[model samples]
Target: MFRSNSTTDCVQHITTSVELTPIRNYISELNLVHHSKRVFKLKLNFPKFIVICNNNGARLLELQSKVEENWIDLQCRVRGYGIGVWLGLTDLQREGQYVTMSDACRPRYSNWMRGEPNNGNGNEHCAMYWITRSGWNDTVCKGKINFVSTFKDAMIFCNNLGAELLELQSKAEENWVDLQCRIRGYSYGVWLGLSDVRTEGQFVSLSDARKPRGNFRNWAKGEPSNGGNSEHCVIYWTTRIGWNDARCTDKFNVACKKQKEIAYD
Candidate 1:
């Protein structure tokens, strides 16, 4: 984009620039500058605008939607400054019970940077972007810095330390899991722990290799259709009762459950 000699053309350019549909587009258009004579500088004059975080995760998705090389370029653009700053609000503070997002959403989707939501200060309730790595982190909701706020992750761990895919034994568990999925901002698919590696269409638990209870079959319409007969893994989704039959190698948000073991000795 460049400035033209004609005044009429400049009017069109400026109008198009500020007409971005999403707020993220606005941020990108503004081009925050940390040093002198670079780009548009941020001013804290607006006190009447509303703050929202529920949509932060969506921007992250858009950022990752770009090609890897392009993503690197965007990262540099944001990282021109030093530390992570607010991009949006998050609900990581509830510790599994709840999430407080910048906006109200039934189920939140989270794309936490690696090992994040580590519960910083136990008071970190908002989302921040780590400019250096272009990863997301949870920060104090009311911290000094302002404004701002996953793509599906690749599977690095082949095994879950002998743990099986999560098997929901009750309605409450299923609802809770679904809620968590939404809160994390997942709308399409989320990988579950059920697979048919052993017995072709029959799904079994990765832990005990037992067939799941027959009553609670959550299959999306025409699902488990195994379109090409190659989908052996399952992914739970809130939109569909029947989880999606996906390829095991596909990247997705994985679900892990921790159980306390009682010592008899």
Candidate 2:
């Protein structure tokens, strides 16, 4: 979670906050790295910056491999940690106020250090794995140590065939999506990306809130009742051919989704 705040851009985790400013009149280019066990290098214009994204290790192993090597723990682990991404809002103009970048990753899990990201002196804008530590931290960007990055923009989490959490674009898309889930052997039910997780009826896609609710047809004719506000997750009810909100804890199949990779020039 790299964020830019008013004074500095500090990379924090999902829950923590940071401030940043926007640069103007940008130029752009795009390149894709399609290989395994390779450090992804993204060459963006500003100052000729280079970002390396990774995606081969398991959840915890991914973080560990970055910091622990040769049985020697460096000062910080440099993978996927940084306040590099510009939140839509920046503190460059307004100070001390900040909002989180959009949940483009929609992480299913997180490991954060306690009371972390104090942003001491406002220099710690990059996300890093501190030495002798189990969680993560925000630190100054300039350092000799390695850094972490992710290839979220170029990849989508789906089956090899590209089957994923159904995006309900229209009634027809919805109908086709059900078949995709069923073919995948999710007969019991399927977990949808939609949820009232943030608010009751105004359900939003868990991955990117900006995604319009679009045309989710009648909720199984009588579903998504909010269930006393206990149900926050949504799912496609196969039997009903309509949408339903359910307890997030209640196990069910899930739909995979990705947001349009946002790039500014």
Give each model a TM-score. Answer: 0.42, 0.35
Per residue, candidate 2 scores C-alpha lDDT tens digits across 18-84 of 2212221110111111111211222322112223111211011112232222112221112111112
Q: lDDT of each model, Cα atoms only? A: 0.44, 0.38
Model 1 poorest ten-residue lDDT run: 6-15
Clashes of each: 24, 30
Q: Could you tell me the TM-score of candidate 1?
A: 0.42
Q: How do the residues 1-265 of candidate 1 rate in per-residue lDDT, one tens digit apiece?
A: 2332321111011122322122233232111112212112223111111122122322222222224324433533432323443443456544633233334442243456788867676876555556556666766554432121111121222132323345666676677667655543344445666789777899876656777654466777778877677788887755674477887755344444435210000
RMSD of each: 18.1, 17.4
The best candidate by TM-score is: 1
Stretches of model 2 off by over 4 angstroms after superposition: 1-165, 210-213, 258-265
Candidate no. 2 TM-score: 0.35
lDDT of 2 at 48: 23
